[model samples]
Target: MKDENIKKVLLLGSGALKIGEAGEFDYSGSQALKALREEGVKTVLINPNIATVQTSEGVADQIYFLPVQPHFVEEVIKKERPDGILLSFGGQTALNCGVELYRQGILEKYNVKVLGTPVQAIMDTEDRELFVQKLDEINVKTIKSEACENMEQTRKAAAELGYPVIIRAAYALGGLGSGFADNEEELVKLAEKAFSFSPQVLVEKSLKGWKEIEYEVVRDRYDNCITVCNMENFDPLGIHTGESIVIAPSQTLTNSEYHKLRALAIKIIRHIGIVGECNVQYAFDPQSEDYRVIEVNARLSRSSALASKATGYPLAFVAAKLGMGYGLFELKNSVTKTTSAFFEPALDYVVCKIPRWDLSKFRGVDKELGSSMKSVGEVMAIGRNFEEAIQKGLRMIGQGMHGFVENKELEIEDIDSALREPTDKRVFVISKAMHKGYTVDQIHDLTKIDKWFLEKLQHIIDIDEAMKKCNINTLDKELLRTAKVYGFTDFQIARAVGLEDELKSMRKASLVVRSRRKNYGILPVVKQIDTLAAEYPAQTNYLYVTYAGVKSDITFENDKRSIIVLGSGAYRIGSSVEFDWCGVQALNTIRKEGYRS
Candidate 1:
């Protein structure tokens, strides 16, 4: 029943920028407001983060800078008498609050409808035992797990699952209160913390080295479904997706494997009856076709934002439309504007998202990347290939060092041991190991990172070696171009050539490289991320810079005066979504001031 009688909708925004819940919710919430307003519906947003764009004047019809707890939301509902409330746009904070409101009959008391996926469906996915039973009913393979209420039950479940089990709390966000326990002592300790987060804890068999793959699935009330994007974690199952380096449109999966996972994703979303955007995670073994359904996030998640940006698919916009009782075919792609929302996005370029960890800022904090998320921010970079993408992503992380070529002098006795332990600097450590003559197979055995990625890192090291053999004057245009194509900055090239002052060498090299490039008529061209990869005429401005091709796809119009609003690069601890909110507001102000943005 497509009932579109929604007039005034209340939006719950993620309260404050924290580790697990962060700016992604701000992005989603902002998009949801735009979506509702576009449909001629009035929006009332409740968020304490005054720094958010959604809370800015005019974004919402009525803005209450309040907390997202159930009491406050119920009060808002009673006072505003909204027709509907959207819980999917915000992070776990809003979803949990919505569930509590539904349980307490507050929504019913105020006659407010919960838009998007039903509350029961949300519960079914959030509760481990319910999720397992539901998947089992649909003949889907899931990790063997048991939800326990007490320590005794948790102990028994862990013992049955054998040593090395994963403990997860029911309603935790960003894998909070989750970890792998190798023994009873570890299990007890982890479960104690996990139980504090939620009433129930899940003790499941650990698939430590299995490939962690995620699919951003969307569905409508009419059962129309499509995958917006799929991502693969560079680190295996042991690491949280937020803390690990992730790549979109998984590079390791075979064609058959990709389709198989896609089919499974579609099946899971349909079976779960997810009415908006949902992210499905899977653990797949490379040795065979064996795979296990890890879990499903029945809301707009951090991965959803990454997927949207990576593929140029406005997932939050489409999700908000779907939540407002629109079917997939009823809405057009917001980016391409020509394609329907039902069309699955296709990608010609690779996107690498590296987590930015600021562990050094803290004292005595563990730097290990594990089941719990430790990254405060992340940066996404796009390139034609994995090597280029990874290198670009590393630089975009705002870390001091350039790309993967810089050595982090570690006095480690065993390289394999260091690689085995997951850390924020593991990628750089692996690069240093490869530079020290560690083969791909050796590193693979230690780190469990795919050999394909290792070979790509080796390629970077090979370029560094080639650069080392050439002086600034001797560096040919072809070699310099090759280095640039693989995502080496001018400073990195200067460093590789044994320059004392990298800034001076970079300036000199830049001049020479520019003159040589002019002589060879070699230059970078901007390309649009049209979601169709040029298969269809897409009217979109989303773009990336690449030197692989000659023809520039962007055409500038000089008639209008335009201003560019630079966003805070990535979300960090102290300055997060607040800056993003500021950037969004600045763009809005620029447009309002009669300037093109």
Candidate 2:
């Protein structure tokens, strides 16, 4: 049955994008608003950000361009009197504001229902002490830590936890006010910052080198649950996920480890009574197969957006429907059309997400990345293999990098020190070290990167070295095909074959390489992303270009004119979700006109 009580809904919008919170919320919020409109529910959205698509005309019934603070939201609640409110679509800002409003009894006074996860459940996840206690009831293994509400308590907890403990602010987002302290002096400085952001702080044993893995899960009101996607960080535990390269469908985990974590994620979400979507993070030691729950985000997060695009699962949209008194079986998967929302998406390709950081715009900012997030935006690339996916992701970041190899050389005084201390230029430093005849095992030992990934990097270096020994004409079709399969673009291949000086211009050399590759019948094929891995017949517009595939999964229709709508590349400063909204609107118009987009 449809929800009769949810005649009108108030949607909280994440305000202006900051360091920790970026355009990911804009994507999630827009999706939630679209879902509400589909259900014929009138929507009132309050966001000061005019540039967002959710604030655009027709996305919501009413738009309030006001601050999302508690007092401001309470006044709007008193005036609008919306029957329900959605807090999970927005980022930490909206979640925090909603919690504050609930604490002040504003939600109860207005008779407004907080949709998705219950307020108490949200509180359990936000407060460090409460989260630990609730998880303990279910026998879940969380980090060894102590929650402190005051400075003295924080000191005592740190002392008990021993030196080199990590301090985290309760209810913080994107790892804000979080850092590792090796001594009491560092502890006091970091704890003061942590206390400023939140009343409660958690001091836990540092798990610096453990592998960080994450799962995006969804649960309906009836307790039907599924894990949509899981991602692994290329950089280990110390660096924030937002500052590391992330890969979906974790590559290094054994089959046993993958299923174990998936089961644990479901158990934790079910025990916590998450009504919609949530993401669970874990720090696992590969050698010992031991792990600890890092934290759980009881709402759509940055990883939620990545997971959605990665596996062609609309997580935010499905979560919104679940919030509206719907079961997973009640809703059909919009992308697959033949499957229910209860079905878990199966991926046939790999996806890599690389963060985009614009730290140069700031003055005297700390360049070293740690627990706190420093990236402003991110890019997701899809390929048939990890090598191709990561290379595409590295180039997609728009950091002037031409994939992993063939980048401008870095001037490092000591390669070992550079690898030991990771900065923004660490990846390039690794490339430089490889050029200096560093072995894969040697680099892996120093940087603590997994041997699998390091070996892949070495393979790319080996290919580049082989290419450098040949000119463009001498680069046979087999070598060119191999390069393309590894996600090397025409430009990168041309430069690798030493064609820059011969052609007088880099663009011309790339054109020559492209023409040669096309003549050799080694072209990219378009493949559709079927959620079931082609187990059953399904149709979807989600697609990616890959050179590894021999045949295209989809065929083109020449009878109808196809309109190609190019979307804004990665989210960054000055341009963000608004551009994405424009592209989506264009596609909608094209589809309405009976033309394929």
Candidate 3:
């Protein structure tokens, strides 16, 4: 009873903002919907969260503000008789629901084909014990670990394994339902909380202080695989990669490590049958430089957005086409009209991403880095040089944006301390460090950023500090001289030195015209990393801190309408919608491109 005429799609979306699930899936799902529409395919989206811009007038042909569950999704499929259902666009909730329906013959009943990866592949990747077994066969190095379902079982596994293990609740994100435990008592308390996220938990040796690295890989049905980009987090092993200041093209990597990861990424994607996009996180122990697999998101993710923006590749759109049986090399490129889909982009510059953290509200949580992600949004800067990239990132997140130092409500001292923490805001702290009396060299050593950039930051800080001590409240001749040397405008120096009146006067003055301050190149610019930036520009002055290599020359000669949605920044408060904002713009752009149901 399978219909050869299957073309319409049913997209499952994760529900609204909640403790466990949030809007990121809506963003990705929205992207897929628009992409399908571009190929003249009808789309039906099922998501309970009506607030998303994706549910608005033109994003999809059929929008059902219904819960994404086995029962409801099956009902829609049976009624609408869509050709396929896409679980990859949705988050874990939708993926899990799709699996449940497939297992129960719900999909078979309607003769619906599941788009993206197959159900068995999803199960093999998710079921920890089975996954580990598969990995063992493949010779992928995993940490010493055990999976347990209950407290007593976990205790038995922990006792046999050892104390001071890492306990992570299954299927949780942002390090939710995850923690470090030293003793049996601590383990019991932590496990109790972790249980809320999933029924099974994984306890493994904590890979603290290791180098955290991520690789975003894309594959197509023809088994054509390519690693889009690699990002290295500033924070060490314990902290989540999203919460760290991440740089692409690995500032410190043995050539072999980089290539090995690239090779391994290809292998894993091919093995898992992931015929679209996936993000793989790893922990490299610095002492031995040994690597261990952290986890993999077998779908479009926040990392995918960052990588897409960083690399200049349209990952989401390409993935949709992959689901349609187009190979990476055969599909039409989206950027460079002359190039074929076969060419994997080669980057000539570095890209850095500084995640934006909203720790200004959470006074109690230690701002120091941790295993879980807590970034609300991230800023991207692009530059040819590391120093320029670093500086650009600082300026992008500062002064004007409420998320950073420009947050007028927060005290300078508090801001200073916030910077001192290993959170994503560390670059701003480094910028402030110049005024705090730390030398450029010392700041570089502390933050692990480049030295050339550190010197410039020190100069900026020195000028501000000098102006503050001089008590030059208004436009002073000496202050201006130093400001020029420190690369600060009169207003910036005045703001630093508490010269509000002088800054106002300087702004009002016609004789001294101050040009726009260029972004300090603190973060990396990806030419091809995030597809969101390619389809559009930032509405507000909010630019992501990415490196110069942040764009990709996509090859598209035909006028095929497509979209790229940004995923929510690793999952933090306040800045969470940064991904959503990108997604919203992508949807708009797709509609503008004449993509319709």
How would you encode candidate 3's per-residue C-alpha lDDT over 1-597 as one tens digit per residue?
Answer: 122365798888876655334454555676677678777888898877766756776888998888878888877887899888888876777878888999999989888887778888788777778777767878988777899889999898788878878898876766777777778998998889888788989988877656788998888787778787788876666666666677776777779888988788788778878878888888886557688887777877767776766666667777777786667777655654445555565555556677656666766876666566666656676555454455456556543421222324333465444643465445556655554566766664554444544564455555555666755435465455445432344455545555465546645431232321222222223233332333433112123323234343333345555444545534456545445655666766777778731
TM-score of 3: 0.76
RMSD of each: 1.8, 1.7, 7.2
Model 3 root-mean-square deviation: 7.2
Candidate 3 Cα misplacement greater than 4 A, ranges: 1-5, 18-24, 362-369, 395-597
How would you encode candidate 2's per-residue C-alpha lDDT over 488-589 as one tens digit per residue? 999888889888778878899899999999999999999887778889766777788999999999878898578998877877777787787788789889
Candidate 1 regions exceeding 4 Å error are 408-414, 499-506, 558-560
- Give the TM-scores of the predictions, in the order they appear: 0.96, 0.96, 0.76
Give me the displacement of residue 6 in model 3, in angstroms: 2.9
Candidate 3 at residue 229, lDDT? 79
lDDT of each: 0.87, 0.88, 0.66
